[model samples]
Target: MNLLKKRWLLLTAACVINLCAGSIYAWSVFAPPLAERLSLITGTAVTAGSLAAAFSLANGIAPIPMILGGWINDRFGPRAIIPAGGIVMGLGFYLAATAVTPLELILGYGLGFGLGLGLVYGSSVNTTLKFFPDHRGLAGGIATAVYGLSSVILPPVAHALIETEGIEAALLTLGGVFAIVIVAGGLLLEKCPDAFAKQFTAAAPGKQMAAEECDWRGMLRSTRFPPMVALMLCGAIPGMMIISHCWSLAKDVVGLDAAAASAMVSMLALANVFGRLLVGALSDKFGRLASLSGALILTILATVLLSLSDQNAHLLFSAGILAIGLSFGAFMGIYPGFTAEEFGAKNNSVNYGIMFSGFSVAGFAGPMAMNMLKEAGMSYQTICLLAGTLAILGLGFAYLFVRAKKAAYS
Candidate 1:
């Protein structure tokens, strides 16, 4: 179907697959059903936060396979694996749907599904970058933006499936649908048109033109990396906390019941989509550090709102979430864009594969941080306050980076 001819179709597929691959954010939606089915609770048999932790761990660890996936793509091409990921991801969901116990949920959805997600997720960026090499940021922005949009699309559907058919049936049906998608979408990923790769690599000027040429060895040696990892961790905490505590906050802080709380989660998901795209494209205009700074400031404000109110919390929460989500989106967009801008995309998959584990690291850290805080008798208010403060600290780091950038030029 001449996918390149219909660029829109390709974009749609990319967006769909990307977003769907990211539905890991929607893990919270399953917690209620999963918990109910197993008769567990937050501090009891199971914690939604812990499950989220597991998912983040998987996502962080995803880059490992992505590194391998990129190598495979560079060799055999992308077609077969992407779709296989989709199928496996679906099966993960299916496992979640069918799970009667925690073990199945962890192994099936967390491990198996996560592996599929990792495989396709990184490839999507690599694929989109190749497709629109000229607009790498835009491609990465939109495709990467799906990180949050995944939550927007699936959690509600998952919520409904849980509410309607029960988790088991939902798992079965969704898995079946995914099996078909994997087979179909995987086919399109088969080959990178030689013209595209050739034209792309040829367009670069010197060992200096595009920031995409480097051996994996050089990439591993860069000392400029730690700050980037720090930026990602700082950005991830509150955003993840919001995700982990979506329902709980809506219930406790906002005074919403289950249905209403879920609805708010949906709203957060919607905002997340907007945030990812907006922050990313904005980076192209304003520069990466500025975008990061803006997001950090916004995160601080959002956390403030999050710390305030009960039933009257909705409006403030909305404002705070917008900032938090956008900051998060920016983080996703900026990291890949920054990596490519700094090191070049030649070893992008490999470098990012290693670096990308930060997400999982954040995922692991985020929940543990929050849970520890909570267990230490820290209120959500305390956690929100600290997370927001960290955002400010991140802003300082971004400021320093910008200063360094300016210094290099002068």
Candidate 2:
């Protein structure tokens, strides 16, 4: 296929494959069922917070594969890693389907599936960024957007499947389907060819006008990297909490039914999808730091609103959900472009991989706090208040990053 056709095809296929990996976001739907099943088997009560820890643990384990996978992709390209990820992910889902204990669930769904997602997600997003150097934000956004979009599409389907076919069957069916789709998409993925790369590179000004290219080691040495990582860590906390525990919060705190809570997940996901696309495109125009600062501000606002709203105010609750989801999606959307612009694209897979460890930290911090707090009988309002504080901290780091970038460039 021609280079132009290949790029577009890669984007389309990557999006579809990410859709499969995105099922991780639908974990809220699975949590109740998995808990019930475990309860039946072990004759012990399973709390929602315990299951959320599994979700957080999955994200915590992700950085291992993300870094390793990105390093491999840098050397050998994405074809092998992508399909390998699919196989691992499929195995994980299958194992989770048969799991009867919390530890088993964590191993299967948390560690195994997270590893696969890290590999696949990093490869797909990085490849797309490489292909469109001039439009890095838009390209990365388009690629990552589908991952968030998957939350919108998969939850309802998973909920329906859980209701009808049962959770085990639902997991089995999804595992089988995702394995096929991801493998097929991997086969279609190709790095940008030399000719295409040169064409895109040529569009930018001479070296003086382009951003400096820094290797991972060099990037680490830079003053900007630390604050940037901190920003990502803090920025991720609120989103992680919402994605993993929002369903329970909605049902218990908002007084919503199971269906409404499920629908709320979809609603947040829809907002997430739009946020990715819109933030990415907007960053191209307004600049990444500015856009990110704006998003972080919104994140704080959302958390505060969510904390204030209660069971009686469903509309306000939904609005809070939308805002938080959008800010989360926007953060993901901006990251690839931000990383490339700040460090350089040549080592992006690994550089971003190193940076993505922030998500892992957030993963541990967010859910663990929620689970611990809930176990201690703390109100959900406290979680929101803490998240909002973290968002403020994130915004501060963002400002430092912006100043550092300016000092370097100027």
lDDT of 2 by residue, 1-410 (tens): 67666777788888999999999977888899989999999999987668886677677787788888988876677897999999889988998889989889888888779889999999889888777766776888898898878877888899999999999999999999998899889878875553455555433221111267777899999989988988887878888887779899899878999999978977887888888898887777777777788888989888888888788888878888999888888888989878877777677888888887887777667877888878998788778878889889998898888788788868
Q: Please give the CA lDDT of all the candidate structures.
A: 0.68, 0.83
Quote each prediction's TM-score: 0.81, 0.85
| Model 1 poorest ten-residue lDDT run | 202-211
- Worst 10-residue lDDT window for candidate 2 reads 201-210
Q: Give model 2's TM-score versus the native structure.
A: 0.85
1-410 per-residue lDDT for model 1 (tens digits): 66455555565676767766776766667666677666542245665655564565456557777877766654565685787778778778777766666666777777777788777877767666556544555666787776567666676687787678877787677667766765566565545554653444423211112433555576665545656667777887768777667778778777788998878776776666777677777666566666777888788888898888557667887677666766777777766666666666655656666667777677667767888898898877778999888887786667666565455446
Task: Candidate 2: list runs displaced more than 4 Å.
Answer: 30-54, 98-105, 159-169, 201-210, 241-262, 307-315, 370-386
Best by lDDT: 2
Off by over 4 Å in 1: 1-8, 25-61, 91-105, 159-167, 190-209, 254-259, 308-314, 399-410
